[model samples]
Target: MPNLKHLLLLSCLGLSPACIDVPPLEDPPKEDPADPDADFTFTATPAQEQVLPGGTLDCDVRLAWADTTGGAVTWSLVSPPAGIELQPFTLPKGETRATLSIRLGAGTEPGAYTLTLQGKSGTVTKQATVSVTVGKAGDLVVNWVVPTPGKAYTRGPLLLQFTVEGGAAEQVEILKDTTVLVKPTGSPYSFTWDTTSEAEGTYQLSIRATRGGAVFTSAPRTVIVDRTAPTVASFLPAKDAVTVGVRDSIQVTFSEPMNPLSVTEAAVGLKTGAGDAIAKSVALSADGQTLTVTPLSDLTAPSTVQVDLTAAAGALTDLAGNGVASAPAWSFSVPTWLPMGGAVSAVGGATSTESVVLKLDHDDRPILAWAESDGSSKNIYVSRWNGESWFMLGAPLSGFSAIGTNAATPTLAIDTAGEPVVAWGETTGNGDERTVFVRRWTGTTWESLPSPTPPSSLDTLFNPSLTITSDNTINLFTSLYDTAGYSIICYQHSNQAASWQQPWELHDDPYLFNPGAPVSTTSGGNIFVAATVFDDHTSKRNIAVYKGKEPYLGGTTLGNSSTTPSIGADSNGRPWVAWSEFDSAPQSDGQIFWARWEGSSWTAPVAVNTRATGNSTPSLALAKGGPHVLTWSGIIDSERSILVSQWSANSWQTMNAPLNALSAAGTPATAPSVALNSTAQPFVAWTEADASAASIYVVRINR
Candidate 1:
């Protein structure tokens, strides 16, 4: 028997001694010493457990003997719950421990259950009980599928996946924030998220899993959906720029940030006019929006450069894995300007010359026409360059049978078959009556056009200007003096017509005199004539432009005190005029001025000559688009020299030096004529006079 203090200590130690019954202190039935009482106690550790419906609980059952000999113990479960399984095992001899395993089926119900365990050794038996509270399975778990976590998707199909654990799920849904994206079916719990229709932005993604009565949600994951294709916002040296610097770098700006790793040298290119690739290095800006291409060496002058950006699959890409929608391409030109070359004598002899006309053939060869004489009657001559020297085209054009007969004011044009056609004013008898005549070189001799009898209304005709249209129609413009007044007339001659068309009066104003009526044909076969007309109101000879025939569309007055106006038409049928005009006051000499017809009206006149004096006979020619090349005669350093200038980049740029010699001791160059070839290279011709003799000289650039 234990004292009250001992009982209290035993209870505090978790051992209750009150459960054990103590017999009175008396004599007991004695047994054989060899057959001592055999007894064992069955117990379980952790007698109470909390679990879910589809969970298992494991416990250990042990048997101990009071006698010295020990035997194996057989274990069994008593009154277990339905659908509950227990693993049965026998404890081996001399072993004091054994393991017990309990498993519940997935379809098991929730309830409070008591499981009994029994162990037997020979004829001795022991029993223990374990209390378990079975409830529903824990909440379902969801996880990411394809794009693990913290990943962005482009504007295309995106696959999402989630795995459910702990229990079978009846329904699963993928959500973006609070909005339901899709309700998926089938196994593996996956959905293909098509993000092509969504806008570019950031979104929170999560999964909702539901069973019979329980619902679970996964933590939100940040996802970025970007579907925008990069674009080229701007380019450095704008497209079709004609005056790009040789050392300029090509630059491109993007609409968004780009991937640095995707920008490589293979993604950009620079090429020459001849389609040859140039060496270049590519670099991306720090912000990844600007890309620059620097050529390893200086670019070629007077050449065109092409810039290209690659649109290949992996060539260029944005940070969100999007590529450029289309490749960007453009071309710019470096101006081709060279210093003037030395002047070369084209035709020189002991002969004096009058007016001269210069024109370039399709191959850039110079063709010249002039009226020359050897102290006698003047004769018309036509010559062309053979790349080395000049050669006469045919015999003398003026076949006069009487003395003192002369040919003057020669104008030249090239026909469709590249043959020289000349028109001149010829004195018919004893240099008294003058008439206009035309001749074409037929590779053998000069073939004269049918001469029409002069109408009785005109007295004399001079200043013949000629233009050949695309259809081989010969258009002639001449200044005439009649009994009424001095007038300008035009005549048309075609291969199909038996004779020249009747001359029509363009301007019949008596105040107009010395009308330098030059004719030019536009690409649309429309004729344009520029002349100097006297304005009675201002009492000045102002330059005027006339278009078409009879009821002329345009006869607008241009510069003041202007003369020797030359007209040319560009590809767009717009007219450009150049002439010589004297300064308003203080300055006494004439200067070269030019203007263009801008569809609605004429632009203000712009002076081209920078020299101080002697600017006359301005000739204008246009290139493919609208660039103007003007040449005129101006005196520099007290000597007459041929000056040249060009309209470029919205302003006129004069050449550094004169085209011919300006030495005071040398011949004076005058009456300059300028023409451009197919490539826009200029060729200039002028007559230099020395003593009583004059010679024709031509000059051009090396390129």
Candidate 2:
């Protein structure tokens, strides 16, 4: 081509004559050829490089050891991956380095890729290698350190952390047992778990990582959840507490959250000192840690109560499913224990005390009737309990201007309508002639029957025992001194306003004489009576028992042989018979013994009192349907105290304290009668000896 400036200038001169002359075009200088003796070498910034699909990697390849000869070099590339794009790059005529830009295809396959650069000088060609590792579709790697096997985690986070290598990750996930705990995290490969709602147990943890267009999974690992067993942190009405109100609820606090259904009435027991379980209900607090036990009925006052926790019944458990380590039991005292009445006698005391009879009124409070012998005459009196003290029901009902020598032993019982009924024997005509009179409470006041329970006859009347059957029938059992010799009599007063029926003979052996007082109770419409009858011909006296459809004792004897018998029944109408038997040892008078009817037959009569010297007048009673209690006069070492015992462990056990410990030579503990309220707590009353000036004393059995 010709120089273009001269032509353009000549054309401009002709067109305008004022055109400036431009310098004549000149050819550039040519450099010398590259030295053929120089050596050639090549290198890359990174020996090996990596790139993810749809990603780029910038790298430098240096051609060092160049000849600098200015010899023109020819450049070309060799062997490049199909998914890799080598951007156009050229090295200067004599340069040391060149840049390589590698781009990966969006859908590239995973494999090793090689990129080569060739520098040619004359007949020689020098090459450098650049490796570009393109990641596959699912190229993201995932790994996790698992929790220790059988490991336990407290109340905190249970985390699942994973490490990703190779390619970049777009999402991650963690899965627990049957649940996906960690959802897809856009960029993070770790997940944290909350341990609160989870129960104590073993579970599996798994991980999944997603990168590009593929997903990867990790082997499952184990995770644990645990919490300690709940503990009894504190309790209300603390151990051995006193003066607690009857209505107060026992509250128990726990150290940790608990399962509410585990706390039950059977799991937590409450019992009176008499070893009778109290009526109660269970309540759980909103926090699931506190439990309150409320008494369904008022607690018997001035009594010790036991609280028990059952370990086997699964009483309480923690969220971890752990139960109490042991069965726990404790006790507290109710100082306000209710007393039926105190000192049922004159202000200064009386000359003598008659047998005291106890009965529970409709409301379950006690009503007592007893006789006081002021040296000359025996007076019969009635009284009602106001929970604390006692007051006379009415003026002396008997033992005053009567038709008998003196109104003697009086007995008490409640009628069908929950009315108090009292019966006593009074002397009439001659000193030997006696009659038994009857009176019933009209709810408002005491009402006297038109006729005596047992009409007077030529025979002397002994003390009588009375019981009201479920059908509201009043039954009378007594020992009658008839012309046919000593005989046991049975009288029934059909309805409330009915007259007495002709007495049915229970035992009428001509050889029987000097009969002791008789006691009786009814069970399941059947009657049980116990009495001591002495053989006139022989000095031997034997106790007799009768079980009949009616109120009379004519059944098999309780013991092999016995004397001075008494009887009682549980709320279930199960009868318990107690009596005195002469001991086998020499100089031993009698030992108190007892037996119970377990529906089919009587239990082997078991001896109650240990002191064989002088045990007499066995009396029996039971907590409505709970433990049984029996009392008797025990004269040991010449002390003459009322040694009381309770029925437990299938035997009689002594009270924590003796019922009567009066050791005074003139003082005595005699004629004890045992009774129980609706709650099954027992109350025992007896005459404190000092016959010259005696009083009726009462004590409550607080287990």
Candidate 3:
């Protein structure tokens, strides 16, 4: 035998016997009484009849339960109506009372419902009935499309037709210009709007149908009438071409003398670039040469404007005896400009994280320069390498704060004389914000041109695009926003004065918004504008390419059904696009992709960087005589660095240069911007992490 402690420890370890024993307890059961009487009962209140397309019925039911035989009782629903749902019930425990609520869906048909209540001491039931009526009324269907968007009536005829089903109706009328044009057909049931002779805006057709001594009126449908010639009804005050903020009136003279009869409160109007109409207190000169349009509120200077003349609405006639057919749509803009630069020393700025620039001036100096900036700043500073020394032009512009921050996409083009014309977007006001501005190096000092120049209602006025035709006619394109659904691109031309030609709207679609800066080139007699369009429906970026001098081009999408990242063209007029490939998994890295337009169709996209990991935001550049270079900042070895690759011999070459060497954890090297200089050398600009702050950096690489 072991010691007591050791023996106890061994027992605890279950060596032989480690069990303990105790006694169990028992409880008593009570006797059962006579079967519990059926005491649970429920009843529903009658619901009022409801017509179709009316409010929901507020229905309720009373429920009660009792222990008639002193036995526990429960309540339950046994019957319910189709399409009806009952809400929670408040039932008591012993002498329980409860309320039940029900909701009927809209599609419920006319019918009676039987509701039942079940009591379970065992099984007993009680039931009641309720009735609801769902009646029917006919419907009117509407369908319409503008053959020509925004133009309203330009060619052919304006036709509108409506159909209604139910009982015979009367009094069908189609209204345009506030006067009824189309009346009910002989059937008195349908209507058609034919604008063979009327002018256009918005026309409404209203009808009333009657059946069984009751009348139902169909909702009004709108038809646009276009019969008038487009006119320049008004020019904004600064059309005096004066600096903004000068107290001035809008100058609006008609294309022809107005009908003193048609220029009423409804016919003549003034509106902002934003589409908000000037208030009713508009003051007009009796001679009608100028109209002083004051806003209902204090106005902001440098705003775009449109002056409309009701004279086109069958009220005025042109000098040629033609009735003014279409309401004139004239657009005017506030001039804004960037005011710095000198003697074309250097040019280029990173347009964004995905763009780069290398600008070479026409000046004889052997200076190599580049420009690039991140979002939120307006300065396009230039750096020059004159073989032995490097010189920087102006300091980067802050957007326009007392410290100016946001910089526009600055594009540089040198006139034949080596004078540099800088086109870009800049902050015009602290609150209203952003304008497309231009500046020229006028032999002595950099001068600002008239600004707030809007290309289209849909344009953002940044990311300017410029193309100098063989004739030196500079064609510029930018993006604008409209109150209506789509964004637009505006076009302007200039050859002599720094002033741009009257701007024209190019692309305006309810489906396209924030189109990328335009890229253009003239081939033969056709002008081509290729831009990135953010499709509202697909929520993806599409490349919309249009041809001709028309403001907008018919757009075509390119690549593997993915949004594009950047686009460019070479001297041969071949357009190039770079974008990210579609990734099957979210959060997966996107691969760099490229596509080319071969004069007929867009080539299928080829993977430029085939990393399962990821690379993105690619920018492309091409020198007339060599391979195309595509550069971007991407992640490698879990680090973010600037990468460049070239397309040569029908294939992509591996990228080797790394612009940033900092730890990749918190630092971001993004928005790779690129440009090509006079010698065909490519210069790239970008914003990089500088230990504690952010700074703009550049690198030049030969192709």
Per-prediction TM-score: 0.50, 0.50, 0.43
Q: Which order, best to worst by lDDT?
A: 1, 2, 3
Give residue 175's error in model 2 in angstroms. Answer: 76
* Global Cα lDDT for candidate 2: 0.65
List the lowest-lDDT window of 10 residues for candidate 2. Answer: 16-25
**Residue lDDT tens for model 1, 311-340:** 433467776668888777889987544323
Q: How well is each residue in 1-703 modelled by candidate 3, as lDDT tens digits?
A: 1123223333333221101111111112232356545455555543232223222433445545433433444444555556555553434334333434445556655444444544455565555555444445343221111111111222223334343333344444544445656565653122223345554455555444445555544334444444444354645653334233323455555553332323445656767778887764444454433444554554444466666665445554332123555655455544221101222222234233323344455653322222334444435654454553556544542334444455546656555566555666666655544676666566555666556455444434656765555565666766565534334454555556556777765546666666665665554445677666776767777666666444333244654435435656677676677766555566356677777777777677677744424566667766677667777767766767667777777877854545563444766676566655556555565556535444445555422
Model 2 TM-score (2 dp): 0.50
Which has the greatest TM-score?
Answer: 1
TM-score-based ranking: 1, 2, 3
Global fold similarity of model 1 (TM-score): 0.50
Among these predictions, the greatest lDDT belongs to 1
Model 3 alpha-carbon drift over 4 Å, by segment: 1-356, 363-380, 394-405, 430-432, 455-460, 507-514, 517-528, 535-539, 548-555, 560-565, 581-588, 661-667, 677-680
Task: List, residue by residue over 156-247, the lDDT tens digit for candidate 2.
Answer: 45444454556666767677766677675633344456677987676787777676667776545655455555668888899988647677
Cα RMSD (Å) per model? 33.3, 32.7, 35.5
